[model samples]
Target: MLCPRCSLSETRVIETRTSEGGRVVRRRRECPSCGYRFTTYEKVEERGILWVVKKDGRRESFDRQKLLRGLMRACEKLPVPLDVLEEAASRIEALLRERESGEVLSLEVGDLAMEELRRINKVAYVRFASVYREFTDLSNFAAEIARLIEEREDKHDNH
Candidate 1:
């Protein structure tokens, strides 16, 4: 690795750690010449088309960061553990990859996100649904919450 301070091409990794459920590697590096130390993270890059078909008839390359950002926004200040969210994202990604066409509808992605968020936290689920479903008024939130409550009640009754 190149040293950021002196632009030296020689550097050595002082320590290495895995995080993000071992999906990412954190490397502590030092420049021998100037004793500059820095940290870097390494992640695996997906190798596939994985196009997303949007509602507006536009297709775009799949962006994992974009999805993670949305999840984080929903789970913000909600006491949801970061690893649980990451695992949900990972499962969603794996599900998409299992699809044969390498393409998925935008709504499908939103639905998957909603389901995953619901499994993590109801507040997060509603937060994500409010945006994904484009709530225009109070009724939207009320109806969604009512439906969620009904579903929970039904599941409880069944048990």
Candidate 2:
């Protein structure tokens, strides 16, 4: 692995752990040159190519970075940790693979992202939902917040 700080081409893995039911490998690496330490994840890509079916009926290759970017944007300026979002994205990808389809609808991707973001942070969830669902006005935001409150209430009641 390359060191993010010094841009060294080599790094040594100091530790390794399997996570998310063995779908991901987390590695702690240290750069010999600069002594910088960082973590990286290796995910198992199961398929050759996955396509995303957008709302306009266009098919394009699924890009995990796009999902990461959206999640990062939603969690920006919040207390949400980057690693938390990364793990959530990994889980979302695993869930996508569970569908057993070569292609998945864009809306499905958004839904999964919203679900993970909701669990990680509610403010981030609303940020993602507003963009993914295309909220038009304050009433839309109000309805979403109200629904979130209701969901929390239902969960507490169940307990």
Candidate 3:
């Protein structure tokens, strides 16, 4: 690594750590000549563009910020922390990228988002689902809430 202070080409790493669920590498380096110390972070560059196949058949590049915005909107006024939502967004992006095909259906993305929200907060899950699933009637909302209740009951039974 190059030293920022003296523009030296040689720098020795003094410390190394991994964070962000091991997706990021942080390194502290020192320049021997200038005795300058600095920190750097390393992250894997996404290999290729992942396309989002819209419901209308229009294709666009997958945008993490857009996804995060949707999640944030659903979580507005809730006790959920922004960092928790950010981590959920990162996991969703990683899951999408792990697919073999570069293209993903919008429905699939919505499902994944719902899954994450359901784990984070039930109210937020319903909020997102009402929009993404286009809940047009009270019955729709009731059905989803009922499903959630049933799942909780089943989980409790298993435990």
Residue 158 lDDT, candidate 2, scale 0-100: 100
**Which residue ranges in model 3 land beyond 4 Å of their true spot?**
1-19, 25-42
Global CA lDDT computed for model 1: 0.91
Error of model 1, residue 144, in angstroms: 1.9
* lDDT, candidate 3, 92-139, per-residue tens: 999999999999999999999999999999999999999999999999
Flag clash pairs in model 1. Answer: none
Give the per-residue lDDT digits (tens) of candidate 1, residues 36-147. 9999989887777899999999999888779989999999998988778877888888889889898999999999999999988999999999999999999999999999
**C-alpha displacement of 31 in model 2, angstroms?**
6.0
Q: What is the lDDT of residue 86 in candidate 2?
A: 75
lDDT of 2 by residue, 1-159 (tens): 679999999899999999766778999999999999999989765757788899999999888888999999999999887878877887887778777668899999999999898899999999999999999999999999999999999999999
Residue 65 CA displacement from its true place in model 1, Å:
1.3
TM-score, each model? 0.79, 0.80, 0.77
- Candidates' RMSD to native: 2.7, 3.0, 4.3
Name the 10 consecutive residues with the lowest summed lDDT in model 2.
Answer: 43-52
Regions of model 1 farther than 4 Å from truth: 32-37, 81-83, 153-159
Estimate the TM-score for candidate 1.
0.79
